[model samples]
Target: MKTNVAQLIELPKFLDKRGNLSFIEEFKHLPFKIERAYWVYDVPGGEVRGGHAYKDNQEFIVALSGSFDVLLDDGIEKKVFSLNRSYYGLYIPKGIWREISNFSTNSLALILASTSYNQEDYIYDYNYFRNYMHEKD
Candidate 1:
């Protein structure tokens, strides 16, 4: 898998006098089918999350409220993405190590996954992830 396959996705947004609305469709806004959906919220100050890669699961991460940064490492390069909009998201392909940090207060992170929860699909150790990338090459 190419490390640069990760991309930023912009969803359809509609502005109204009352409020703004945005929606995401599986296989339309995202490149894959939606099988699982979850959110991370109420994270305390200076707290961080996600330090692993998925062997097969791809993810689309969106900030529903507040802001946060996603650090993506492809074993050769690293990039930081700041998400602060509900209509925008980060598409994380499989085999890329990712970390979420620098969260603003009361930030809500919504993650849409392409697959269900599977323990065997996760690569938690950085060294193991590097080896896995080497093997893929």
Candidate 2:
């Protein structure tokens, strides 16, 4: 069983005095190899995203616009990330429960996943998730 762990993802910095431009390449910029990419937006404040954990999938998230939080829990320790920068990203390892909330209107949450969509890989129920983790012991 895997668990959520707090990790930092390095951001790409572009050099330009007048007009700067930075780009994030899926597998190149992020540490773990990426197999999928997705972004979240058009959300109202107070609306929360993410309440599930993956079996082996890892993710790296970024705030492309506005600001929001990346809340993580390893079924034990919890942490929050306030992302307002376009250049920074958060790395979320597998087995961790995650939530993206407190979106500041029109915020864009970009995510790079380590695996393609696999319904069976998702653990949506909290109790089941806990039980699954314990079963691994």
Candidate 3:
């Protein structure tokens, strides 16, 4: 079984005397096209988000402000990534379970997706997701 692992992508940062700049162009900095964009904020303390995995959609997540930790699991292995910069993003592939946690105060999370919203694409059960990934092997 091959479990795809997420990787960190450093976006272009153009420093200027006025302010800093960063950009992520679809198919240029990401492995997929940008079909959707969203942001997560106002998360209550001690609360977590993203307890599911997508079947066909790929996502790129960035910490636009503050910091947070992303846990990725692929049935056989698990890794944690700390996102604390606006110029860097985590590229999450399909079939991998992801969870977001430990968000700092007033943190902003920007997510770029490859596909539009689809309820059927979500895998909400951990056991079901594990089996589904292995079945592909």
> CA lDDT, every prediction?
0.93, 0.82, 0.92
Q: Cα miss at 96, model 3 (Å)?
A: 0.6
Residue-level lDDT of model 1, residues 1-137, one tens digit each, is 23349988888999999999999998788888999999999988888899999999999999999999999999999999999999999999999999999899989999999999999999999999999999999
lDDT of 2 by residue, 1-137 (tens): 12245576657778788865667775576656789999999987788999999989999888888999878887767899889888888888888888889999889988989999999999999888888877776
TM-score of 1: 0.96
RMSD of each: 1.9, 2.9, 2.4
Score every model by TM-score: 0.96, 0.87, 0.95
After the best TM-score superposition of candidate 1, give how far the Cα of residue 125 lies from its true spot, in angstroms: 0.4
**What is the TM-score ranking, best to worst?**
1, 3, 2
**Candidate 2 whole-model C-alpha lDDT, 0 to 1:** 0.82
Tens digits of per-residue lDDT, candidate 3, 14-99, equal: 99999999999988888888999999998888899999999999999999999999999988899999999999999999988999
Candidate with best lDDT: 1
Which stretches of candidate 2 lie above 4 Å from their native place? 1-4, 25-28
Residue runs of model 3 more than 4 Å from their true location after superposition: 1-4
lDDT for 17 in candidate 3 is: 100
After the best TM-score superposition of candidate 3, give how far the Cα of residue 7 lies from its true spot, in angstroms.
0.2
Candidate 1 contains a number of clashing pairs equal to 0
Pairs in clash, predicted candidate 2: 2-95, 3-95, 4-96
